[model samples]
Target chain A: MESHYFPIVYLFGNENLAVNLSNILMITVSMAIVFFVCFFMARKISMYPTGAQNALEYLVQFIKNIISSNMDWKQGKHFVMLGLTIILYVFVANMAGIPFELATQDHVVWWKSPTSDPILTISLAIMVIVLTHVYGIKMRGLKEYGKDYFRPAPFLAPFKVLEDLANTLTLGMRLFGNVYAKEVLMLMLVALGTSSLMWGIFAFLPTIIWQAFGVFIGSLQAFIFCMLTMVYMAHKVSADH
Target chain B: MSIFAIPYVRMNDKEANPLIQEFTWLDAIYQLAAFAVLLLLLKKFAFGPIMGMMEKREKHIADQISSAEKNREETEKQLAEQRRLIEEARREAKEIVENSRKMSSQQADEVLASAKQEAERIKETALAEIYQEKTQAINALREQVSTLSVLVASKIIEKEMDEKEQEKLIQETLKEVGEEL
Candidate 1:
């Protein structure tokens, strides 16, 4: 009962599929749209300036302004590109789920935010953690990488591995918990609104505001995730870090 | 339909318990394969080139902004220097005009004083010439009056004279006639 995150996983059809194929499609499509929009916005840049360039400039400035303020530019410059992709992609994917509804089979939720799923959140967190290690190795050679694991003592290397693992798992779990809980609340609330008449009118006012709030939270969480990625990298890569 | 309920919301509700089932290793493999395919597709068509360009353009923009800021600062410095130079030039021009004005006024005052002194000296010389002519005319008048007095005395005298005296008297009479003429 506790493990069931309704919107995250569901049956596809009588043919049957493992994951919620529809929700997964929503995620993939949303991510693709994020990628293409960012790409298209940046493809051409005029020396003078254009709308696309202006949009891209703002995106870049926004990321750099945050990254540079939070970390050293030399160590941090390479990070914004990765951070932007992750943040924008996740934000769009999360918000896209709000509008999802099923018309065919009444039981299925047509779409779900990818972050609401353990698999998606865990995958992303793993990506960030793996990248942190990869960048750490690149910045400081593999010798330093293994050596840092011993920091206080060589015997602590195993502990460091466990710590990193724990850290990654927490990252994924925290995101999944929040997104999944939000989806659950939304479903319950929406179900409550539709089950009656007076409740429906009362629910209408809040639903619009709550959906907007959801968008804000979705964007904030994505930003926080990306920001933490860079912060952890800054700690891991540099010797003084 | 049963797969969705594997993580069933209700453990006690008989409605969902029958749907709960253990996921097979084969299903996990299928999920892995599907994920691998998604990753591959993402790598080839989406993440690879798009991420590359995004990074490239991002770097280019950051560099351009920093460079532009540097140039703007340099231009501001140059502008400040030029402004200082222009101010100095204007100050010098004002000083030159003031000096020229002072020198011209001093020269004009000196010229007026000299012209006035020259006019006073010319008037004094003309007055001196008039006084000298008056003195010379007074001496000529005295000589004519004495000659006329001598002629009246000779006409009143009734006496004979020697030849030398008569000649002296005739010369005196001729002198009186010349004075009268």
Candidate 2:
């Protein structure tokens, strides 16, 4: 049962019993294992944090700092939830690419990054954009939101409205493009070495380089998603924007 | 923007493949759902603690700074007190030294005055003894001279009348010898 690299492997119904079971169960089990461990670690958090909780805190603090730095302590503090969610969820998605997809595949390719999928990326982006607007409207009433567009001149309001719309669309698309492009590039690089230059002396070097690049891009892209979320939110909720 | 979504097919060429994949509204819905999940998870656990810890860290740092400043001030104050104590001890030693010197000088002056008084008493007794001795010596000399004068007159009279004045002259000479002795 051969499959293209990172093809959407369905959870059930394949003719080969062994490979089908292997395909569906192993990756999901592994992800479930990661989820439960994270849950237990989260649940067991103490006043004096230990091991996994400490690691968790370090990640939490990192996002907290990012959010607080962008906005007011009170307003920024509220963004912590968003930051934490983005960091944790994206982190989980990014790490999904690490393990072997199935027991059958000699070189493991378990779970692809959820973030790499345009479906996932675009949804999160649009939500982030809408929430920013929602919070903006909440903070400064509908009148202020409308006034913000017309600010300094009543006539330039339409252009300003267009600019805002463009900005929101761009924000979402940018994240999708970056993550998708990085995943595609990594795949191509890996394919080039594994297929084309399998017997070539320099085959391993290119694969190694691209994998390293993949790791870097993956982490950066996750961070960028969260960063963009905070940036859009700050623009909306903050009085200055 | 919608042009990007349209298939880029080769209209002039007979052999061309249109791309199979297409973007759907379902994908957009999926994105929103994921974002909602992400936001929910963030709100529940992560945000509160991270922000709380940060605030705690900021407060802890501030406290440490204030305590450090307080400790420094206390140490400086202790050092000043120690220096002052040393200075005070030095002044006390000087006072003690000055007092001892004054006491010694006063004692010496008292001894000297007593010694001068003792010397005056001894001189006065000696002068009194010497006056008494001079008076005694003058009285004895007067008695001897008177007796000698009597004896001489008796001796001269005895020579003129040799045989008859012999007994009277002997009696006068005996009286002068007794006075001289």
Candidate 3:
């Protein structure tokens, strides 16, 4: 068995229902940052956008394009906020731990990306999948939504269930794995540098290079997450499917 | 493996397996709630007003464009109307000029005809006056000749002579009258 300490807090003195304090803190911080930035950008809305307004409009347009590409405007228009929230939250979470990490000597992590944990990402994935189903039923009616599983052939129903499972796992794990690996490599590099004076000098360049690469990966993942989200949404809501 | 074999830090001390093995329900719930709240707040404050403003701007521009087109068409129509009026005025002026020219020429012809008739009347009166004077002169000349002949006959009767004397008396009277007349 392998174990690592975390800053855990039990709810109602139950071990099974414990919460990781670090994850919660990071999640809150990410949410706060996303909310404030969006709020400030949208505060003084103008017809001819300038400065932050331009950037905000550009982000809206970018997300709009993503949605439109996946589905028509009528169905796609509803998901713009959902897409924006996801991208902003994920991107902020991904970039959070890259600048610095906080951990105790005894392996108790106080600060890291919220998305670095599988529980958070998987939870988000589950929520997204559930929302898709809800929208599917709402837009196409429960009967039609159920009929989609048996379409092209009845035997394909089992495979469709499996595909949903696969989609949730991949969506959650993909984000978790990439962010986790990047942080791990960054920590390892820092550890290697601190191991000796000679290694410290050599590890400096690679650490900087890795950090730069991490930025690119974080942004790309954010975009991919948004894109896949709209695609899933299109699958659920659109009539042509 | 050898590189990670540091003295103070054990390989197993790192928190690697906890990521998969540990699952926390509270953390997930907290994150989901936070995300949901953020989405709701952002939708109300950010996306709603921005989208409304954009649509408003688009409609305003469309209205302006349509109004401008309408104004342009109106201007063109007025311009054409003005041009037609000017053309009508010019035609009327030309018609006025043509009537005046015809009137002046007609008056000139009438004046010339009246003057010629007046000149002809004057000439005819002058010729008639000269003929009357000539006729009067001829009558006076005939009367003088008759009186002269009567006087000569009276003088010859007074002489009272035979045929041979009478012829001599008449010859003498003719010589005397020739000398005197």
lDDT of 2 by residue, A1-241 (tens): 2223322221122212112122233234433444455566676555566787788778777887788767777777666666666655665565555431222243234455555555455656667777788888987789877678777788998887787677667765665565556555655655555565443446667656766666676678778878878887887777784
- Model 3 lDDT per residue over B64-150, tens place: 999999999999999999999999999999999999999999989989988888888887887787777766765564456445654
Question: Which stretches in model 1 have alpha-carbon errors above 4 Å?
Answer: A1-19, B1-181
Which predicted model would earn the best TM-score?
A: 3
Interface RMSD of each: 7.6, 11.7, 8.9
Clashing residue pairs, backbone N/CA/C < 3 A, model 3: none
Off by over 4 Å in 2: A1-65, A72-74, A95-111, A138-144, A182-209, B1-54, B132-181
- Over A68-97, each residue of candidate 1 has an lDDT whose tens digit, in order, gives 766678888777667666667677767876
Model 3 misplaced stretches (Cα beyond 4 Å): A1-4, B1-16, B97-181
Better of 1 and 2 by TM-score: 2
**Poorest stretch of ten by lDDT in candidate 3 chain B:** B3-12
Listing every candidate in turn, what is its Cα RMSD in Å to the true structure after a full C-alpha superposition? 8.8, 10.0, 8.7
**DockQ each:** 0.06, 0.08, 0.28
